[model samples]
Structures are given as structure tokens and as C-alpha cells.
Target chain A: MKRLSEERTKLVFEKLTKYLGDNLKVLIDRPDGTYCFRERKDRVYYVSEKILSLASTVGSDHLVSLGTCFGKFTKSGKFRLHITALNYLAPHAQYKIWVKPSAEQQFLYGHHIAKSGLGRITENTPQYQGIVVFSMNDLPLGFGVTSKSTADCKHADPMSTICFHQADIGEYIRSEDTLL
Target chain B: MDVVNAILEKNVNSNKSISVHKDLELEIDEGTLLASDYNVFDKENLRSSQDTYLKNLTRDNVQVLINKIWMLQTERVDEAIVGILPKPVFVLPRARSVPKPKPLTKWQQFAKEKGITSKKKNKSKVTWDEELEKWIPKYGYKKAKADEQKEWLVEVNDPTKFTNGEDPFTASKTAKREKQAKNELQRLRNLAKAKNVKLPRVGIPSTEHFRDARQLAAATTIARASTASVGKFQSRLPKEKDAKDIASHVPGIKKKRKEAPLSVVQEKQRNKKLAESILRSKSTILHVDAPVPSTKSAKSSNSGGKKKSSKKEGKGAKKPKGGKGKRDLRSKVGGRKRR
Candidate 1:
């Protein structure tokens, strides 16, 4: 509901920059309505300025949720983007992977993506880069960090992890009832 | 209303009237108003019911304040009469302590050490100026006895030994200039002494080497504490000579830091507020031991939105619709690969 402080902004921006890269600027400063990141209950919400003002009118005790839940800070203060942030991350994501239909359910169930499940990967994708996982039809499902670069993937073991699951659409079904 | 009086009479059953304070200790400002009551508490009545006792006390104090305001002189302005409030009678604690006596100057310190007391040199401030034909201040504005301003002619006691037109006027001007320059230097030295800095013997400012060494030491210390990384993967070069005396001569980089643009501070404050707001919204009860790596246990914070409801299906975690058979099947995460 309020603006973020310098220390918290550093933490959130570092995590967000991992996935969005230079495009993180575009996500924060959009051509649409002005958007802001607000932290409530250790969770960061990316809401438009208008929604933030409205949400602020409600007392903190009664106010539950507003805008999109991007992620939450762990008790130790590390930021973790939730599955809800996939919408914002997908378009601006620098690295990407398409999953075969057979591996879609496994990703949704929070299992790491096996090399065989990777249908396609972006050219020259670097190892451990944050990437969006999509269906073969180009539907954004979840996001994760690439386990190996595109060149390494060609010779990687078929059963080895290609992408480590960070968040997925399944979370929209779990613990996300209050998410706007 | 008379209801309070009626209540007092009805509740008290005894004849003793409520004893209240005689003075109204009210302090009103541009918008803030404060009232302090010095009356003794009715402990007996408070033990039975605090509500009535405090209420009665407030009523009496308010009534006195109203009477005091009405007693003031009123002025007619617009539609209503307004009485200007007089200065408050109560003595208030000073907001700031009387500034401690200014740091002692060099002369004062010398006098103190020697047990010397100052005595006035002259009582009379004026002297007769023969040329001006009137009394003038010995040292102040418009002093007519200054040698440069007064000297008009010179007398030669021995005509052979003196130049005919020679006079003291020009010599006096140079003397005055030199005296003023000396005072200017002393003034700076006095100021430095008050600030607890020792100037070099030759000048009011510290020497070049002293200054450069102080700056180097501060820079070295700041650079070391500023970043925690061991220069990351790279090895550190030979350490620069530590400037030890800099701490005694100079304060920390506090003044340099304050010079940062105001926008930086505002941005920092905004981020801080956002962090606080996020912390405020999180449910505190559910926070337990750090599960760390996987933080995905999201229970609907709205109390009613319990996890694993049988009536819900696999539509999404937000609205679960599953059969009764999977109710207690185990695992916090839904369909998580559990063999």
C-alpha cells in the first residue's frame, strides 16, 4: 500500500532483474497505467496506482489483497517471485523454454524439468538463467532457471534436469484464493 | 446537562460534595489544546467504577475552562464575538536546553591557568580633540583624534634636523592597515581553537602534508568498510599505508553523505514504506521455523479459506474441488510427486 524503502527495493529489484533483465525497467515504468510494488504480509503485490490508492483506504487489518501477487519475502528477507508473477515475467523474459505436453503435468506438480521434457529452448540461452516455461503451443505455464545452456543441453543426459521449477500455474489453484 | 448533577446526588447517598481542583490548567496553541488536572483522585470511587469518577472529573475541569475563556475581553468580528486567549500561566519545560557556554578561547584558557582576573583599563570613553574642538570616543565610530585624520602640520624644534613638510599622517595609515591584518589572522586562530583544532605554528590552516595524510586515511578506512566482498574473486593489492592521525584531526564522512541529492533519500523512504506495508499484511501466526528453499505453503490468510477442502476440485488452489477419498491423503503441496 505504501512505497518501498531503499533496502527492500534493492532486494526485490535484484530478484526481478534475474528474470526480466533490462526489461525490468519497462515492467516498472509501463506505458499503461502507473504501477507500483507494495509489500503486505511479506508478499509483494504489483498493482496499478489507482488500485493502490483504493486499497490504502481500507485498514490494514481488514484489507486482504489487491493487484497481482508477485512474490513474498522469506523470513530471512530474500524475495521469491510466486507463480502469479508469470504473466509479467513471460513477455519480458530473456530466456525461454517450451515444454512437451507430456512434461506439462510434471512441471505443474512442482518437479524439475527433465532434459527430455524440453521441446525447444531459446538460442544461446545461458546456464542458470531465469526462463519462462511454455507449452508447445506457446502458452506461458511457469518459470524456472535454466539448468544448462542451449549448447550444453544438446549433449546433456536425457534424464537430467533441464530447468529447475521455481513456480507454476498450479499455485494459482493452491494458496492463491485471495490473489486479485 | 443537569443529568450529571442528578446522577451525583442520586449515586452518592451521602452529603459530601465532589471536591474538585480550583484552577484550570489549560494550554491552547494554534490548533493543539492540552489540559492537565492537578486534583487528587477519588481512589475509593475509582476502585468501584473508573468510568463515572473520570467522567465527573473531566466535567468539572471543562466547566472551569469555559468560564475562564468567557472572562476574557471579546472583539466583534463577522457574526460572532471572539475572545483572544491570553498567554498561558503554566510554566513549561524548555524545549531545548540552554546552549552550553561557548567553548573557551585561548586567552581565556591562559587566564584561567594563571589564576588571573581581568580589570578594566579605562573608565572614561571620550577624549578632547583640540582640532575638532569637541569630545570624541577614544575607540568607536567617528573618533576625531586618529592621527591620520587629525595631523595637519609638523613643528621643527631644530630647523636643520627636520624636513619642512614632513608629517605623521601617512605613517599612521600604514600602521593601522598592519594592525587590522594581524587581528584578522588572530580571529581565525581563535575560531579554530574553540573548535578543538590545533593550527600549525606558521599558519591558521593545517599544513599540506597534514591535510593530505588525513584525507588518505579517511579514504582508506571508508573504502575498506564500504564494500564487504574480498574484491570478489580477485586478490587485493598491497594495503596502502594507514593514516592513523586522521581520526583525531577530522570527523567521519557524515557531512559528505548528507550532500547526496534529496531524490535518493525520497526513493529510499518509499522503498522502506513498501517493505513495512508488506510485513504488516502477512499473517503472523502461520510464521514458524524457516522452511527456507521452498516457501510455497500458501494457506488462504482469510481464516475461512482452509486448505484441502473435499468439496473443492482441482480447478486451482484458490478453489479446490476434490473427492472425499483424498481428504487426508497427506502432503502439504497438492499432487506433489510423493511416489
Candidate 2:
């Protein structure tokens, strides 16, 4: 089990701060250099030695194991933000589209929100930009991309579609067997 | 025990004669005492004959039979106890083993050491900023860069704050404007000079040079005079009136002879009769037995027939003459060649 060096953690933290902004803090308490991350052959990030130790101590086996590749680390290596990491980070996301109650089930089922399903979105959010989508109760549903800007939406037809769902917990559950 | 004794005494006193009856009656009457009787009376005899009768039964079989009997007794006791006691509700135990963890690599180990866990918490501890009215991180609230914040702000111009100010580059702008105007004026003057400078005529001389305005006026007068003469000639020539007009004008021409104005019913009847006559004529032509009238006779018959029939013959005659004329010309040319 390898641990990330202080230098590597700083590098990752800096990149995360730039990419995710305030959302980075939700993922890490602080860049204390105690956390360990494994880089897979496909460039995905995963919790390795530290999580294994935690698992042994906690006596629990269920754990999130994969993180998505976020931004370029070097010309060759890339930094990835884990999908599970987004669970903590979603609340801190600056841009968000709050989905309607009627669209909650469809959103969890990994269907993109139709224009009408866009109940409330962060003001001044740009079009084609990545945004977090939440349910009416403010439970983060998943990540999505805005199809139209807030200004475009003001004059847009009510029936026009708006956001595209990227990933969700429901998709993870449905694909758990295949993921393994 | 008392019931068994009473039954035994009754059986013994009632049946004293037959020994078989007495034995059978005793066996039947003493149900509780049967096992004791087997143990006490039949034990020695059964032991002696055990080799012969119990050859098929194993120790296991005997033990199983004893256990089955014991179980039945216990089940009866349990049923009685259950009838008196309250029913117990059973619950399944919680699963002891957790789900299997996904395999990790070296880098993940490093990441995990830095307080990273594989199990990401679904609920975020990030607090909502009341002032900002948005969710914020637990620690180290990162305010967006001023430039980024500016980018996110909707662009709006304050019309009320707009002030009419003096032109900042009045001298340069006015000089440039005057220069552009001078250049435009120069271009216009050059275009006028180019237009005024006459170039020698190229290509063939125009025929229009032959006629001056006076010649044109004379030509117009000649054309007018010719048109007037032509109109006078046209007026002097007799104009052929329509047959309906001729009939109306000439007293001798009967209105009935000229087509009378027919009502819809009359027109339909006339059309039907005309169709019947046409059908009769077509049938006559189609039938081999019906003689085809000679050309002269056909013409005379057409003239004698109704005006409609004469009109139909006239149309038919014109079509054949066109073809016949060419044939006649060919024949005449052939005759001349023969001569």
C-alpha cells in the first residue's frame, strides 16, 4: 500500500482547487498528506492503502473504489475526481439545476432532465457548462451539463429541454455487477 | 390405573369360559399396562425368540422406533403447553458479513492514507451560507476569483447613469471626417471630368445617324397616313355578320331554322336525339350489309339532313380534303411524269 507524498498531495490539491473550486474541501478535510490514492492503468483514481486500513478497523467491506479522471496532471498523467467523491462535493458546487419532484425518479434512473423538468437553476449559470442537479429536498441527484443558459431559458419555450444527466447513484446500483 | 383395573375385573368376570377370549379381553382392556406386560411377561419369551423374529430389525431401527415414540409424546406435551402459553414472534438475525470491497492499487493506498476513504459519505457536511444563500464548504470557503465572479454577473448598462459628454477626439475625428468628405468630393469631381471628356466613337457607325428629328416626324406622318388608309379600306370592305345576327336582321331567315334558344330539358332531349342519330349513322357505317352512300349522294344527304348533321359533315369534309389534296397533287405530278 503506497501513500501519497506531501508534494504529490499538494499538486493534486492545487489542481482540484482550480477544477472544483470550493467543492474540493468537501472531498478532503485538509491536504494532511495522510490519504493514499492509486492511479489505475486507465488513469482512474481509487482509494488504496488508507481505505484498506480503515476497512480493517471499521470491519466494513462496502466501499467506493473508483474516481473519474478530472483534469490533466502532466502531459501523460491525469488527475481524476472519483464519482463517490462527488457525493460530498455536489453540495458545494456553484452551479446547480434543481429538478422538479415529477422528474426525481427519472433523474435517478439516469434520464436527462427535459426542459420542463428544470424547476430552478443557479442564476447566471452559463449554457453547456457542467452543473450539479438536486432533487426538491436538496439531495444531490447527479452531475449534469446545462443545455441552455439561464438567460436563454428566460425567453425559451417551457417545453424546451435543459440539462443532461451525466452520472447518478442509481446508475451505479444498476451497474454494480458489471462494475465489479 | 383404576380404570384399567376396573376394565380388567369386568372382562375377567364377564368372560370366564374361553382362555383365548380371556387373554384377548385382557390385552384389549389393559392398554396402559400393555408395555409393562411386554416387559414383564413377554421379555423372557421374546428374548428366547428374538433371534427368529427380530432378525430383520437392526439396533438402529429399534432406536429409531423408540425415538419416534418419544417424539410423539413430547409433541403432545408441547401442544398442551402451547395452548396455555402465549405465541412467540420470531425475528431473523442481522447479516454478519459486510459486502466485498473492491480491489485497490498502490496510488489509491497513498490517496487513502491522506484521509481519503473508499466509502464516500452521501451527505455532505458543507454548510449553507445564509448571506450568499448557497451551500458552502465546512472549512476554507473559497470565494470565486473576482474575474470569474464578474464573468458570472449578468451584464447590464445603467441608462440613468449615462451622461452626455464632449467628444474626446473632437479635433482628430473632425479632421478625419473633413478629410473623408474632401476625398469623396474629389472622387465626384473626377467622375464628372471623366464623364465630360468625350472619347472618339469606336465600332461600326450607328444607322440612327441617317434619321434626324424631321425625318422621324415625316416617317411618323407616313405611318399614320398608311394606317388611316388601311382603316378606311377595312371599313369599306363588307364585314361578314354571324349567322344568328343575319337571321335576326334578314326577314326571310326564320328563327326556327337558325338554332332556337332551348330550355335545359329541350337541350338534353335534342342532345339525346342527336346521340341516337349519330349512333344510327355509326351502326350503318359498321354494318357490312348497309350500303355506304356515294360521295355525291352523301353530300346531298348531308345537305338534306338537320343543320347539326350538315355541320358535322362540313367538319368531316375539311379533314379528308387536307389529306386528299396531297394525294391529288402526287397523282397529278405522277401523271405529268407519265406524259
The candidate that wins on DockQ is: 1
**True-vs-predicted CA distance for residue B283, candidate 1, Å:** 38
Q: Model 2 Cα displacement at B166 (Å)?
A: 97
lDDT of 1: 0.64
Window of ten residues with lowest summed lDDT in model 1 chain B: B294-303
Q: Candidate 2 lDDT (Cα, whole model)?
A: 0.47
C-alpha positional error of residue B266 in candidate 2 after TM-score superposition, expressed in Å:
99
Worst 10 residues of 2 chain B by lDDT: B313-322
True C-alpha contacts between chains kept, each model in order: 0.02, 0.00
Model 2: runs farther than 4 Å from truth? A1-19, A25-33, A41-82, A178-180, B1-339
Per-chain TM-score of chain B, candidate 2? 0.14
Q: Model 2 over residues A34-88: C-alpha lDDT tens digits?
A: 3234333333343433454555454224433443333123443434333454554
